[model samples]
Target chain A: MRGLLFSAAICLATSPALSDPLPSWGSTENKSTIISFVESVTDPTSPDYVTPADRIAVFDNDGTLWGEQPVYFQLIYALDRLKTKAEADPSILTSDILRAAAEGDLETVAAGGVEGLLEILAVSHSGMSVDAFQDDVRAWLDEARHPTTDMRYDAMIYQPMLELLSYLRDEGFQTWIVSGGGVHFIRAFAESAYNIPPEQVIGSAGPTEYVDGQVMKLPGIDFVDDKEGKPVGIDSRIGKRPIIAGGNSDGDFAMLEYTTAGDGPRLGILVHHTDAEREFAYDREGHIGVLNRGLDEGPDRGWVIVDMARDWEQVWPE
Target chain B: MRGLLFSAAICLATSPALSDPLPSWGSTENKSTIISFVESVTDPTSPDYVTPADRIAVFDNDGTLWGEQPVYFQLIYALDRLKTKAEADPSILTSDILRAAAEGDLETVAAGGVEGLLEILAVSHSGMSVDAFQDDVRAWLDEARHPTTDMRYDAMIYQPMLELLSYLRDEGFQTWIVSGGGVHFIRAFAESAYNIPPEQVIGSAGPTEYVDGQVMKLPGIDFVDDKEGKPVGIDSRIGKRPIIAGGNSDGDFAMLEYTTAGDGPRLGILVHHTDAEREFAYDREGHIGVLNRGLDEGPDRGWVIVDMARDWEQVWPE
Candidate 1:
C-alpha cells in the first residue's frame, strides 16, 4: 500500500495536466512540440524569450478555429440574405450571381472566384450602417444552426483551439486572427469567441464609406487575404511580423511561411482534420479548408502538422 | 513669529507639487478639468469610472503633438525625395506635379487638393519595400532640422503634450496618434519621440501591395484620414470609440466631434496656437494646421480650447 501510494504520487506529479498546460490537447508529438515551444519562448532565461508585446500569435479563423465544411459561415450568411431579398423582390435577382446564390448553388457562385464572391457579398451586404450589419450578423449567429450537427455556428468552434487562445493570452501573448475571411464578419464574433479584441483581428476588408453621419460598408472587396495576400494583410494591419502562426488550409501557407521565416524560435502549426467520425475530415480536393500545399511543404518548413484525430482528445466543447 | 512659522508649515503641506500633478500645464481651467476627469474615471468609487481598456484617448499628430508648419513634416520628406529623385533622373521631373513639388510651390499642391496630394505621395513613396521606406524616413528625421527654429524636427514636439501623454499613460489610458499624415512616415518617429508604439498610430496609408518576398508601397493613396476620413479610419483600425480626443486644426474637427459624440462623459480639446512670440501663430488662413472651424465651433461643443500662450507653461522642451 505504501508502494502504491508512492506510485500514485509520482503519477500525479507526472500527470499530463502537470506536464502539459494545454488540457484539451492529447499527448501527441504536435501537442508536446507546442508546449515545449511555448515553454522555451516564455522562459526568462531562454535565448528565445520574447516580451509580451512582441509575442504575437496569428491564427486563421475558418478551418483553424471552427468547422468550414458546409462552405464558409460567411457564405452561408450571404446566401441566406440573398434568398430573403430575392423572395421580397425578384428584380434584385436579375443578376445570375444573385440567382445562383439564392438557389444555394455554391459551385457556380464560386466559379466567379474571388471577384465573383466579392460581387455576391457586395450585393448582399451593402447599403447598411456598420452597426446595423453587426446587429444583423449577431441575430443570425444567434439562430443559425449548422446542418451537419445542428449546433450553433459559434458553438461549433474547436474546444482545443479555444483552450490554446486562452493559454496564449495567459502567457501574455497578443493573439490575432489573420484569416482569409471578411474583416466585418470575423470582428463580430472574434472578441466573444476567441478573446482577441477587434483591433487585433486582421483580414480582407470591403470598401467602407462614411456618409450622413454613418459609416457604411461598400459592397466591393478592395483586397483579398488568401494565399500570398495573407502576409500582405498582416503587414498592412499589423506592422510587426508575428512569432507564431496557426492555420488549417493551403490559404494559410503564406502566413505560416512569413511568420516562421523570422529569426529565433518560431512555431507554425497546421491543424489537419483527420477525424471523419467526430468531425468532417477532408483534404486536398475538399470543398473548403483544403490541406494540400501545406501538407507537402510543412515538413520542409519544420511546421507541426496536428492530426486532429490523434492530437485532440476533445474535438468540440461539451 | 510662531504664528508665521505655523502658516509656513501649513503652506508646505499644501504645496502645488503635491496638488497639481501636471506641472508643465498652467493652473488653468483646462488643466484642472483634465485632472478631474482622469481622477473621476480612474477612481473605482466614482460613478464615472472607466475600465482601462475603455480608457482610450486619440490625439491628432501634426500641430497637436508636434509642429506641422511650414508644411506637414511628411510633405517636406516627400518634397526632399522628389528633389533627390529628380536630380538623379531629370525626366522624372517631367510630370507637372513633380515640377511644382520640386520648386516648393505650395499653392499649386494645395490647389490640386486631396487627389493631387495623393498623386504626389504615390510618386514620392512608391516602388520600395516597407523596410526601405521606413529606413529612408528614419534617416531624414535623424538629420533634418527645422528651417525656422534651427532645431531638430523631432525636438520641435510640444513639451506640455509630452507630459500629458505620460500622465494619461500613468492613469491607464492607451494614447493613440490619429493623424492625417502617412502611416509609414508617422510610425518611424511615433515610438521614439512620443512613446506611442507603431501599432497604436493610425494614419492615412499610401497604397501597399504584397509582392515577391516583400511588401511594397504601390504609388497611390488608398485612404485619407482627415475630416470625415478620421472617424472612418478610427472605425476601420480601432472599432472602439475613444472617450478623449485632441486636435489643433480644422482637419481634426470631425475626429473631435465623433469622439465626443459617443455616450459617456467625454473630453475634446483644441490646441490654439496663441503664442506668436514663442511659436508660429496663424489660424484661418494658415499655410498648414489651419484652425478655423474648430475655433468657431469649439465653444458650442463644450470643447476646451487650449491657448498656447496661456495654458502652457512652456511650449518646446528645454
Candidate 2:
C-alpha cells in the first residue's frame, strides 16, 4: 500500500500554499518535467489520465537511489562477510578464493573474475535460513557506514530521488525499485530506507532452496537484474511493463528502453552524476554503474537526463 | 487492483436474505469455513482482522482452479506447436525427440525425463517475440478443445473456485495464482476467466532475452515453480508470505506448509477431486496432479480438504 500521508496530503506544483513536492530538486527542467508528467497523467479531465492500477514506476537502486562510489556496496558487504566468517570458523579460509577474499586481496579477488566472485558470494551468503540472512543483513546495514564519508549507507541516498519516489506514490503510482543489487540485502532495508516494501523491490537473486521446512539461500546466482535482465525480471515478477523507469547507468539501458518504448505517455529518465564537488564523478570508465552509452544516446532516445550538478539543490539526505 | 464490487460488497454470513456470494458452492463446511474465515478477518472489531493490503491469498492453477487431467493444457499447446512447425519446415521433424513429441508419443516423451521435456519446451516456445507468443497462446485457447469432453480448455475451470476467487476479491483480498504452469499461457485468459490480472500470476518461467530492442522468450526453463520452488517463488515474487494457500498435489505441500505455519489466522486448503461422475477422480496413481500425501496429512496439519463429490453444487460454469 502507499503510505498513509498519500491520502492525507494534496500536492500541487502551481499552488504556492501547498507543500513543495520536491524541495531538494532545483526548479529546473528535471523537476518541472516530473511534476507536469504526473499531473497530466492523473488529471481525470485529460485524455492522458492513467488509472491508479496502471500507474507503475520503477527505479534502479545501486547508483540511482543510493551512492555506489569506490565500488558497489554489495561487493563491500561480501568482502566484510569474508572477514567476519573467517574470524569465526577460520576453516572457511581453506578455499583459495575465500582465503584471498578474507585477506582483503582485491587483486586476487578481481583475477578470480565472475567464478571467483560467485565463490566468495556463496561462502558469505549460503548455509543460512532466509530469516537469518535477512536479520544478518539488517544488522550489518545498521552499523555499516561508507568508508569515504563515514555516513550510514541509508543516509547516502539522494534527497531528490527520494522526493521523486514519494511524489510519484502520492500521484497514485506504485513505485518499485528494479535493482541490479542482491535481492535479500535490498529487502532488509528498502522498506525502512525508501518506504518501498520488499514486495515492490525486484533485484538480482541467488538460488533459493527449501530444506527442512525452511527457505535457504543457495550458492550461485539464479537471475541477474542487470542490463537486459531488468526487463525480464519486470515481466516475470511484476507481470507488467512499467510506465515510468529511471536509472543512472548503462546496466539499466534495456530497462529504460523497454519501459519508455511502450505505447503512450511513458517516461524514461537517467541521472548523470557530474557533481565532482559533492559526489565522485565518473562515467565511461567508471568501475560501477558505467553511464557511457546512456550518456551518448539519452537525449536522442528521448530520455530525460538529470544533470546531477545542476538539477539538485542538495545531494545526500541529511 | 481488486474489482470495484469489493467496495459495494457488505458480507454478513448470518443474513439469509442477502445474495449468496458463492452460488456454485454447497452449504458444506468447505464453503462455510471459507466464508467464516473471510468474515472474521474482515470484521473491524474482530481480533482476526487483517488489513486489506495484508489480505493476500494464493491459489494453485493446474488442478485446484482448473482441469489438468489428460495432461496439462500447456503441454498440449506445446505439442500442437511442434506439429504445426514440423509441417512448415519438414526438416525440424528430423530430430528424434521433436518427432516423437510432434507425434504425441507419450511413452517416449515420459522416458526422456525432465531434461527431455525442457528440450521439447525450448523447441516449442523459443524464437518468438513476447507479444507474438502471447497472441499464439490466446489463439490456441480460443480453439483448443479437450480430446474426450470436446469442451474448450478454459470452459473446464471449476465454477466453485471462480466464485471463491471473486468472493475473496470482494472481501478486500488481493488474490494471486501461484502455479507450476507457464505464466504466458495463464495470462492469456486469467483476467477473462478468473478476474485475476497478469500481475498476480506467478509461475514457472523460461529465461527472457532482449533482442532487436524487444523482450523475447529464451529456449530453456530458468526456474520451475514446483515442489520446493513454490515457496521460493512466492517469497521472491510476492515478497510476503501469503495468509491462505490452496492446491491439489504433493508438489504443493511446501507451499501449504509455509503459508499455514505462519502466526495469526492462516488457512490451508486442498481440493479433493472425488466426484468421478462430474470430473475424473484420481489420487495416488494419477498421472497429473496426484493427491496422495496431501490427502493423508491434510487433517493432521489443520488443512481444510474440500471433497469435490460433496462440496460443489455445480462443477463447471454454465
The TM-scores, one per candidate, come to: 0.90, 0.91
What would the per-residue lDDT of candidate 2 be over residues B1-318, giving only the tens digit for each residue? 243234334333434336688898889877878888888988989999998878989999999999988888889999999888888887876567778998999778778888778888887888887778888988998888999789999889999999888888878888999899988778888888888988889899888887655779888888889888899988888777788999999989999999988778989999988988998787788578888889889999889999998999899999
Model 2 scores a C-alpha lDDT of 0.86
Model 1: TM-score, first chain: 0.92
lDDT for A11 in candidate 2 is 33
The model with the greatest lDDT is 2
Writing each residue's lDDT as its tens digit, candidate 1 over B180-228 gives 8888888888888999977888888876776654778898777788988
What is every candidate's C-alpha DockQ against the true complex, given to 2 decimals? Answer: 0.37, 0.60
Please report, as a residue range, the 10-residue window in candidate 1 chain A with the lowest summed lDDT: A14-23
C-alpha positional error of residue B47 in candidate 1 after TM-score superposition, expressed in Å: 3.3
Q: What root-mean-square deviation over C-alphas does model 1 reach?
A: 7.2
lDDT of 2 by residue, A72-158 (tens): 888888899889988998988867888899998878988888899999999888889778888988788888889989988878899
